[model samples]
Target: MKAYLDIETSSDGRITVVGMYRPSKDLKQLVLPNITSQEILDFLNDAEAIVTYNGDRFDLPVIYKHLGLDLMGCFKSLDLMYDCWEHNLYGGLKKVEKKLGIHRDLPDMNGYDAVKLWSKYETRSDRKALEVLLKYNEEDVLNLCILEELLKAKKVED
Candidate 1:
């Protein structure tokens, strides 16, 4: 089974939320300071592979920095961004999504927006901001799944 993962962090690098998408399961968001590290690990342990965009350089490092868990070799990783580079495809996740015609609910949302939403939640206890951030995160992971499928189909065709 594959797990699609994404994380949202504060400016100082504290993780605010971690989202996971697995087949046949509802998208799960672990809200930091409320959820335990062990809980996150338990969820990840079930997956044979983890899928993400730029995860090797960004998401995985941030997860290790905050959780103190070295995920290297824990499971096979499918880094879509790295695959794109290998094929000479350039641009970040959003740009690649556009190139592939993968639609997202919030086209303007980005990591900075996630940070701002986190800040709003932190300062004023804004539930809506947190909800929006979770939604953004959910889309991120789901889109990774879409991209993975596309890549797999292309590989088969080749």
Candidate 2:
């Protein structure tokens, strides 16, 4: 019931992926139909909790606007960005990795970089933007497990 979700979207409201993760296996990436509101909602309707990094402000609202529906429903949400910030856990993901002593070195390309990638594609009709976006999106969702573990450990120590 703990669903880790992340999204890759275009500036024009087209969703590229609604990446979903389960603990038993590697995270599964699902491509959403182009700009279809209902399909997106259907994908998200049954989660017991949705966990994301900075999703409360960014990702969820983007999907909400597309769906013409409110996401403030029964499912609980944990925004890792806000949680980390609230607890004075500064530093980007790399910093967190150092502080938490996690050894994995993640890619430097982030959501902002994705915007730039899209811009590049817009000019030259290149597909690298989508490629970068997909890789970045997958990384974001994959890290959710590590983050949740770190947070829970912090809670236990407190």
Candidate 3:
């Protein structure tokens, strides 16, 4: 099975949430203080391939540095950013996503906002901030699936 993944990190590089979405499964967000490295591994244990926008450079390395889990070493990785580059598309995930007409529920959201949200939740014990952060991550992981399908259809058409 393919796993679509994204991660949200604090400005200081601490991981606040690990968002993982597998097709036909509920979106899972492993929030801080409640997550173990093994739990993250177990969630990804059955994945034969991993799909992400710029995972090779950002997500995968972060996962490795933080959790010491070499997911790329364990599973095949398909970085959609490279696919976009081949199609003459450029920029980060949200930019490429917009170029391809992929819809997002939280368009105004970005990595900076994610960090701020985490800060709010962490410092003030704000549940609403955490909820919004989770929802933002949910959109990020789920949209990756849509983006991959669209890219595949484009490949077939060309």
Candidate 4:
């Protein structure tokens, strides 16, 4: 099985949420401080490979830093950002999404907005902010799956 993963973090590197997507399965968003490392490991157990945009440098490291789960070399991974670079595609996920005509409900939201949403939840106890952040994260992980399909198709053509 293949899984797509993404994470949202606070300014100080605290992981606020971790999102995962698998085809034919419900998308998952694990809210931090309430989530367990074993839960994540269990979810990842059947995944033969994980796909992410910049996961090698960011998501995986943050997961290890916060959850004490070092998945860097243990699992097979496809970093879409690196794959894009090798294929001469530049820019971040949003940019690539736009170029590929990938549509999002919250097209205006980005990583910085995720931080703000977390801050709003932390400072004002805004559940709505957290909800929106989870929605954004869900979209991110889902998009990774879409991008992985596109990349794999492109590889076949090449």
Candidate 5:
């Protein structure tokens, strides 16, 4: 099975796992405090392939830093960023939308925005930031699935 994951991390290294999705299934929100390093390892162990929007550059590295787990050697990881970058398309997450032909009304929120969101949450104790962060993370993981479908179709064409 394929598992799609996206993470939101604070500048100080706290991670909130946003979402996980499998084929024929809707995305699910995972409680951040309930996650552990071993659980991530277990998910990587079970998944035949893993998909993410910008996982290689950001998500996986952050997870490795926080959890002391390096997934580089463990699973088949597909990073949409690398594929886009290979074509000289440096545009980050929005590239996924254009490449996959998916429409989402997400604001121009990126990881930097996530950092700012956490900052606001910490400084002002604003719960809305947390909710926005979760929604941002959820879109990221779901976008992975959409990109995967586009990739598979291109492979067939090739």
Candidate 6:
């Protein structure tokens, strides 16, 4: 099984959320206050491969640094960002999504905005901010699957 993953962090680089999406299971998010290494490991227990956009450089490292989960050591990792490069697609995930015409409900939101949303939830106890942050993360996780499919479908001849 393949797992698609994404994470959100605070301004200081502390992990606030870890989102994992598997085609076979309901999306699972490990949010701060309740986020734990065991939960993430368990969620990914059956995964033979983990897919992400820039996971090799970002998501995986953040996970290891924060959770000590070492996902790449446990599972085959396929970073779609490299695949995107082979097809001449460049830029961050959002930029790549826009280039491919992938729809985003929170189209204007970015990682910086994610940090602010987390701050709002933590400092002001705003559930709505947390909700939006979760939704934004949910997109990052779900869209990995879409991006993977589209990348796989691309032809070198094009």
**Which of candidates 3 and 4 reaches a greater lDDT?**
3
Backbone clashes in model 5, listed as residue pairs: none
Candidate 2 lDDT by residue in tens digits, 1-158: 66777877666656557776766445666654454556445655566778887778766787677665555454588788776776678866656656776554335665567666656766686787667666777777878888878888887887
**CA lDDT of every candidate:** 0.85, 0.68, 0.89, 0.86, 0.72, 0.93
Per-residue CA lDDT of candidate 4, range 78-97, in tens? 88999888767798899898
lDDT of candidate 1 over 54-147, digit per residue (tens):
9989988888877777665687888899877765568988888888788999988999999999999999999999999999999898999888
Model 6: residues with Cα > 4 Å off, grouped in runs: 156-158
Ranking, lDDT, top scorer first: 6, 3, 4, 1, 5, 2
Predicted candidate 6 versus true structure: per-residue lDDT over 43-142, tens digit per residue: 8888899999899999999989877888889999999999999999999999999999999999999999999999999999999999999999999999
All candidates: TM-score:
0.93, 0.74, 0.96, 0.94, 0.78, 0.96
**Candidate 2 vs 6: which has more TM-score:** 6
Backbone clashes in model 1 = 0
Candidate 5 per-residue lDDT, tens place, 1-158, comes to 88888887667778855467766455666545766877666555567766876788877788788777777567788887776665454677766576557766565777788789877877897899878877887778877777667666766775
Name the top TM-score candidate.
6
Off by over 4 Å in 3: none
- What does candidate 3's lDDT look like per residue over 21-84, in tens digits? 8876767889997656798778887888988889999999998998888889999999999988
lDDT of 5: 0.72
Best first by TM-score, ranked: 6, 3, 4, 1, 5, 2
Residue 154, candidate 5: alpha-carbon lDDT = 65
Better of 1 and 3 by lDDT: 3
What's the residue-level lDDT of 149 in candidate 2? 88
Q: In candidate 1, residue 37 scores what lDDT? A: 66
Estimate the Cα RMSD of every predicted model relative to the unseen true structure: 1.4, 3.2, 1.0, 1.3, 2.7, 1.1
